[model samples]
Target: MPKMKRGSEIPHWFPLDVAGTIYPSARTRNWNYTYRSGFLLKEEVNPGLLRQALEDIHSRFPSFFVGVRNGLFWYYLERMENLDIVRRESTYPCRPMNIFSRQSPAIRILYDHRRFCLEIAHCVADGGATLTMAKALLARYLQLTGKEIPPDSGLTDLTEPPKPEELTDSYREFYVKKVGKPAPDANAWQYRPPQVLNYLKVIHGILPLEDVLPAAKARGITLTDYLMAVYLYAFYLAVPKSRRSSRQIKVSVPISLRNFFPTETLRNFSLFTNIGFDPRAKADFSFDDVLEAVKGKLAAAKTKEAMQKLLSSNVAMIQNPLVRLIPNVLKRRVLQIGYVLAGENKFTTPMTNLGRVTLPPGVAEHVEQVEGILGGSAQKRINCAMISDERFLHIYFSGDTKRTEVQREFFRLLAREGIRARVECNIREEEDVE
Candidate 1:
């Protein structure tokens, strides 16, 4: 690691984590593989105040105040010449970050009316870290606008110095050697939703947590497990019986590494478990069966001991001497091949739950909702992300598919079970995209 002084400020650079190294090589024009998160405020945004807030926020998070640079061996992050300036919102979310361009920031902020959105390149961080940064930016912007945010509140401050532990690659700290690795899931049946030109449908269902939590509790499973069951059931309904084969139906559930490890570093510090159900074995596959299957798979896969092996295996590959000696050109070629062979094709779709976001009283009063939107994966058309505040869980369905069958079936399942569901989308009667 090297730091340089340009006048009064010193900038720092770092190596990408084991997971992050895949993104630079794996990204394509269609599947940019980025994500966006934002909060809907009661009042409109003030760009001048927001710009100042971003500068302050960037200063506190040096890990994000950098750009991707290709090193002789591996790619690394170097400080950007100019910190990002806030811009207005775009028609759609999760646009790719052109990290190779000197003008672009790895993470950019967009604002329009009452919404403040952060579109982050996956290389910088995952949902947990990105949401943490979003809340901090919001809190700081509100304070600048003459609102009083309490010191005792859980909101992080812009004035606090960056802690060393916060910038650590936690995988390195938590890794331990293991005998074997988890086997990849068998090929799964994919949902190939019909596609429209120049448009991606983003439908959100804002339902009361009170309505959904009970159903999850009644089945003796966590909220995530219950929702995943709903997703699997939804897939079962959407796909034609003729198209479905003996292939398993799997959903990639991203698990936050913070739960098992002790660290606050905001880099890519999460792993996923691909939980699947094999419909071929049983003639009658009920929702109860789906729920039980999900619960069993999660229990077996998400244990601390299991995750330790996973971390160890991934880090071992990155740290391998033969892998390290390979040039960047050859390394990228190998990664690109691996991505196609064992990437999104192996899982049906990705399902991420951002849990709940708690805000300070000042910030909470004006904030109505928060949303996490995942970019589409290759060939895999539909992806789901959810975020919750005090009132409702906002579930976003992001895809280029023409049909809304998955969204319709999933929410209808909830509605039939006594949960209130409302549908909203970004499409107009006539016009579409940019």
Candidate 2:
């Protein structure tokens, strides 16, 4: 790993990673790409102890505690000093963050009752990195509360000094020139419902792993592949029959580079592969058909070589001399346009599975559950994200539209496969209102 200043000696400002560069420009007046992941503890949260725990682990994850600043030619992260970090839980998850504010921290630490939530801007880090920090914070909080949790359970040791590799930009480090970029994709079919201003409805399905794993194993496919197939099929059922044959339905699956590369950088280091089927081509696509398509695409796209090409393409954009020289003001517009044309427009929705989460033997006993939520955007109005604990997989579907057809169909499909999920939501119907 490349070495750099550690702990208090680390620099206060640095450039955003290859993946981080686009998020700053993609933000609208009301939204940006932010996500939430948190833990449900066995006991109610103690505000004073949670605050103290954050302060204790604050210096360890320096990359996450900084604010976004505009340089003449680019956006960079500047460490915010003496800023308050923790807050009371809001009614909704992944609310738009004010990263433009000088004093705003890069991540939000929120707690409610027994839940400890971390909301992170995509520019600062990806889900994998956020989980690392969450593990550390939870461990420290438990330790402060008189638990004997070991740091070995994927938790960063607060006693040890921070590693330089943890703050490095792994995407740039692993970028390989001369790799051919992947073929372009067509615009995907998206579900559009009337918007609910400033409102986000979150629905969670708690699926038992024992019930779900056998279904995936029986198909000889990974859990992610199975879930992606289910997600796509759900969208397929929701599409109007008239447009089903012509419209292409795609779900973007994010792959963590850490799986293919050797690095521990907590910053964003992942790429997405769009997987779906064209009904025009398949004619009579079945659930099995969707699963086969997802498995095949994932098998080809998840390789190190394919990811290298995607990573190189992203890095090459930032390296362009002309692109780098464009003033920040104009660059933001160009990037936003590029995002619509090359990013969200190409995928119907994103389904990110953070995989199984484990805790120390002692910590495990105190944790009740773990969950993650992918915030919806203007274009991708509904998004899905999930994380699994020892016994159950918690899937959260968050949407800003008034419709729940897609979310309903997703869990319903799982149920048909004999995989029962305990479903819950935050929305109160109009009739329920006083």
Candidate 3:
């Protein structure tokens, strides 16, 4: 018999949300679609303090603490009695959550040295939701350590009950008037980078935000647009000149649904727009050409009208009686196929920018860096994720390949523009498998 930790909250079980259902149904051995988001603090994490933080935050973020359960119609969440306490990071980031067994929680709080990460299944929440949870956990951990965080530290107070709105599916609420059916990116050219070891090679390129902000401003584009252009251009450089099969070098950028719709639901409430240029244009396109094309597409897609239509169409599909009637097993199979073909396969690669991450002064003082990682897809060998703090903007490149040519070219492009990057990698120098 184990004694419950003090300040622990009663966990409640619930059904998977609209967006969550698709992830569990479509997940596979090679394509789990899992993601990791966390902060690197200035000090080593205390497992005991982190456990307390988890228990405290679980009470506040009940929506995030449950385990996955199989239902007749769909997969659901079941709250468990005990939490799998914070443990040392033993493997790669974004490993699959053992949802079928009660042994695993939907999200795992992991620590290694100064890094405290939240490895979450895509089923429970998106990056934004996870970010909020991470901030709250860090705040509570700091509070326990006698560090006083401000009242408005952007951390959710753990003393209060979970908000009713936070548990609701905001996607179904804001969506209205379905416009048109969504299409797949079957024609998108997928990159086939050389395969190396089974482990992911994550390269973190730390650069000063000031170095690239001016470059983006000079192009009259946002920083994200500028970064996207740099990546697309890097991919262009990596592509063999003779291979002109890919019509466009598409990059999938996720747009947060909270921007247009007003909702505090921590569940998945984001949509994505694939923005890129056709590389097969009559004239060989320059870097500026790619930047301008990406800028135009992203600018147009960010509008309220564009987002509403996209969300509404997705809701319409889920709301369809026909979609709901399919058996869970059959639904899983169909979704697995649909996901491989229409989902990430459409884009040459996907890049997510969490944008600028701000912390309360108390917590910010102890944080060294923050990073976000998205696993690669079947079609795309590597995916890019970005996060920025007060000092630096960190871009992480994760893939199964050993080749650093793309990463080298990417940093070189930045250096060419006076945006110097301090590069670090996980693998040892002598153990170059490639």
Better of 1 and 2 by TM-score: 2
Candidate 1 deviation (Cα RMSD) = 3.0
Q: Each candidate: what lDDT?
A: 0.80, 0.86, 0.80
On TM-score, the candidate that comes out on top is 2
- The residue-by-residue lDDT of candidate 3 on 255-288, one tens digit each, is 9988888899988988888887888774677788
Clashing pairs in 1: 194-402
Please provide TM-scores, in order, for all candidate models, with all chains considered together.
0.94, 0.95, 0.93
Per-residue alpha-carbon lDDT of model 1 for 354-418, expressed as tens digits?
99888877789989888788866656678899888998989999887657888888998888778
lDDT by residue for model 2 (211-262), tens: 9999999999989889989999888887667755366889899999999999
Mark the 10 consecutive residues where model 1 has the least summed lDDT: 1-10
Cα displacement (angstroms), candidate 3, residue 262, comes to 0.2
What's each prediction's clash count?
A: 1, 0, 0
Q: Where does candidate 3 have its weakest 10-residue lDDT segment?
A: 1-10
